[model samples]
Target: MHHRRPKNLRKPLLGGGAFLLLAALNAPAAVSFAEQRYHAYKISRPAYQRQYGSWARVEVPAEYRVNAIHAALLHTGKVLLIAGSGNSQKNFDAGTFDTVLWDPVANTFKKVPTPEDFFCSGHSQLPDGRLLVAGGTARYEILDGEVRKAGGGMRVKNESPDKAVTLKKGTVFRSPSGIEYVSKTDVTVPKATREFEVSYFGNGAMKPWKTKVTAAEARVFVEAVEEGPQALTTQAAQYEVVGLHGEDADNVYGLAQKLTTEKQDFQGIRSAYEFDPKAEKYVPVDPMRDARWYPTLVTLQDGRVLAVSGLNDVGDVVPGDNEIYDPKTRKWTKGPTRYFPTYPALFLTRGGKLLYTGSNAGYGPADKGREPGLWDLEKNTFTGLGGLTDPDQLETSASLILPPAQDQKVMVLGGGGVGESEKSTARTSVVDLSKDSPVFTDGPDLPQGTRYLSSVLMPDDTVFTSGGSGDYRGRGGSDVLKAQFYDPGTNAFTEAAEPTVGRNYHSEALLLPDGRVATFGSDPLYGDRDNTKLGTFERRVEVFTPPALHRGGANRPVLGNGPAEPGADGRATFATEDAGRIAAARLMRPGAVTHTTDVEQRSVALELTRGRDGRSVTVDVPDDRTLVPPGWYMLFVTDGDGVPSVARWIRVK
Candidate 1:
């Protein structure tokens, strides 16, 4: 039965008064003070009662090691967890790259060796059931020391000994190091003695340098023949450094430096690899044309994958260059595509165009490469969409192309300002691309603001959103405990049970075979948001079972047999316990989700025909790969009572 809102209450009411108002409003249209006020001005509305769900905290094996900086649900039903550095620059430098295959069925973790620091990398599931992991952190930034500003820029000395001087008296100068320098003015200095020494800053303090410079060089270094109170005094040189401001030509940026000095590894690698789940090892593939870190790997309609954004070999944005990896050729080729921002939430539209949702996973400049639009591959044109309220908050925001691929409505949910400097948002917006001109309008708002939210579309047509921070990267005690469900049918959000632990950046959640959702990973600020050294890394996994599964008894539809791989005819046979009562069938591509968006995730309703025996059925798969891309999908059969069956994995080839 459809629930209707009373005439007087067109919109939901807020607070304790909502319950009483909803009861009274349930009556026929009538004039009242409450109704008058509701009509006069829009008020903060109360959230709908949550379509309930339950969460189970799964114990992780102790040997799992690092947090899941990246995760994906593979076709083999095992989750791929990768944490190259595990969010620690020290570990990354130590060649501490780790990859693990987590088997949900066995509740066990198995180690897999990866080539490089795939930390902060991007990946997509290939048509052959392998995952293509691209780009990774090659080096780390070291905060050497503050260089004194001089000559309108930074000054350094050409001294070979690399002296750290507090200018006793002259103008500051720079040398081959290209590090910053501070300028100081002083009268004159008598002669260099044990009284003055070169000093450097390290471990949070200025230490004296062991080596001493000649009096002639020292006089030229400080440019001071006389010394006084206003005069910059020198401390003993504690250290000799090649670079301080990170401005060295070899460093690329002021930061990107090689963490490892091994002969086999450089700072960044242009290498790519495919994970072979069968052998539990990563096999090397053809290297990418350019090295990337934090790029977005999206599987295209043609079964090839597109790699976009991320820091290049020089530790800068990859510029306008984008590449496509063909599974057939097992190679990457430069594509005729324009640059989208690093890690842009790119969705493959039904029209085969890539849709940049304007949401990104915290890389590149805030003002550049972000625009909500459809990127056409053939014509290389982008038709932009406007009317979004907070484009800035789109960073780390989550978005989804609503279920049943036929409907081109896309919805963007909670996000926040770039990086950890800003607050999270509760705002929600939706755009219907089916219209001639699509513009985002306000949808139901989140109960509270959040960022880094993982919104997974469930089999029942409701979106299950979990694992986000109320603040940026789960800091400020902003770990969101509660989960929620979004029902397109009601166009509202309902609260669900919160998970056992806090989840933030590097966290992930995806639908499981038993109709439950698995959630794990939160490596924010190395897991120590609070100053207390007792910080803990979130490695334990949690599973959430929606209310639909709790309906109990034998009412759940059970599929007996179906084609593991369906061809162009798109026919798959199945014997279901609830065959006669089967209401509908759906083929949902299992999501290979990470960050905030799942590029290849989608759901398509299948045409079902019940066999005459009332114990068998035939499903018509989508012949058009455009509608149902050639990939693995979860085939679900929903009974008359609206309960979905445990999905049968199938390949829409």
Candidate 2:
């Protein structure tokens, strides 16, 4: 069942004049507070000094929530999205589904036909510009035909069986089955069971696959693939590109499901094949470490095919064990895993650090969820992100290494882990990934609670979070299908228009071509839902337009005094009760790279923005939030408006 979102939340896309940025108001009356001592860091960008301020307020119905999200990039410079279930969060032959695609230019989510599969893990655009997708119990296309660069989608039934994959040159597609056809008749078709196949094409959308059984090939330990199941998952991912580039969307990477007896003595594995579109036959690359299901494969900028995370040992997560395949070397290297096991998600930072977040104890699919965790590629370490602290109205937390700016910060949103046990949480935590102090601090809480949410950073540093579990902790509560905003300027969050419908398990919020946002997810509340083996998916798609570009500059100086006692861990402590003025103190050090402190007490509005001109000092009464607590603190400074800016160092408690 697919449906379009309601009207109120569907604020149409703003044309040229429809957009405007609200100016910052410094109208707050100045109270006669005592002054305290302080050290100010100078900011060079004056045009942004006062302007980098921000604030956010919730704007939607209090109850609506979001579930799951599916995202893809189109050649049209747009992001196509599909969502499912807020009420039930269905997907797996469970609940209803919706479908929609967003046009960033028009700022609209044009509703499309219901998705064919409730569970599709992979999505990619074809050389002909067709969309290639893999995942679900089996694979099939929601598309109508062939893919061309400029044209829309077309449906081709000849290769329409589950798990048919297509790749275009320059497109991010991989597989052992991507091959070229010697003849149209020569095609290696997958068997009818779950033994799916992924085929990559370089010239045409696809090549002839050799489906016919070859005794000669079988005699040499080659098994003939008859009817195949769909792929485990698919996205526009290719093998890693090391030094130079080679081949193209030349190979196909996907899974083949099989019966138990196939490898009973051993843990049977679905074959992972690569079809060379140029070569037109199935070339066996390395199989997944063995029977791991739903693995995410990404082609690093260096051209290495790194498999992210997925279910192993009967649909559960086996932490660490990052599977890597080298196209040039045609081999596999299992990357380091975090802890013994983790359900961590893999994300690349601006510095190319493969970051994994969230974790689970014991068998991920079976046992309990743990506190937030992260895997750092650069350090080869696994550490906690936040604690049991709940992130409000967020779902399935996400992290992004922001592009450099006044608001440079690693943002973490929502909470929600596996199954009914782990539902929604209402906490939004932002961590300063800098080497020194100010490590993890609670950012603005989500207006509501959610988890399994989606967040992305724009060029200007503005961040967006949308859809997930309503409670947001991910421990099983209300399914949420809504959108929100994070203004790095004020370090606050704001909710968008009301969620037209509730989405639970299957939905996503994606960015569009013209910079608008698209929200697509499951909606069991709708009608005519299909109950397929894949899952009861939803596709209630919605679009959102931003208020205007709010490019923030340097962070404003805190109204606290500093140079206080530090902590063993290195965070600075500010005790307002012990001082005359000021509470929070911000200190930044660019040259020495260490800044930490607390106001002497009783201080406000230090105006560190002028530090770049020289050193700006001010006195104030310590802030209550700072001095009231008895802990170490750190002084940090930023030169941005929309977010906290400049940090010199910190003093721990």
Q: Local error of candidate 2 at 163, Å?
A: 29
Cα lDDT listed for each candidate: 0.70, 0.36
Tens digit of per-residue lDDT, candidate 1, span 236-319: 222122333432222111111221211111223467888876677888889887677778888887889988877764345777
Report each candidate's C-alpha RMSD, comma-separated, in the order given.
17.5, 21.6
User: For candidate 2, what is the TM-score?
Assistant: 0.43
TM-score, each model? 0.74, 0.43
- How far residue 78's Cα lies from its native spot in candidate 1, in Å, is 1.2
Worst 10 residues of 2 by lDDT: 590-599
lDDT of 2 by residue, 1-653 (tens): 89888776556543322443221132232221211111012121332223322222222222222233446544344444433322232343464554444344454445444433323233322222233332222211112232111111111111223343332222221234542111111123232223335577886576555453211100001112222332221232222211223221122222222211122110112334442323322245454552333444433434454554444323334455666655556566777554333323444333444434342211243332243444555477656555335522222455554433223355566555444344555666666555443355777776655645556443234566655555322223255545566767677766543444444444444443333445555533223233222334443356554433223212233323445443343333322221221222342211000000000111112222222223343322233222212222223332332223222222222
Give the candidate number with the greatest lDDT. Answer: 1
Best by TM-score: 1
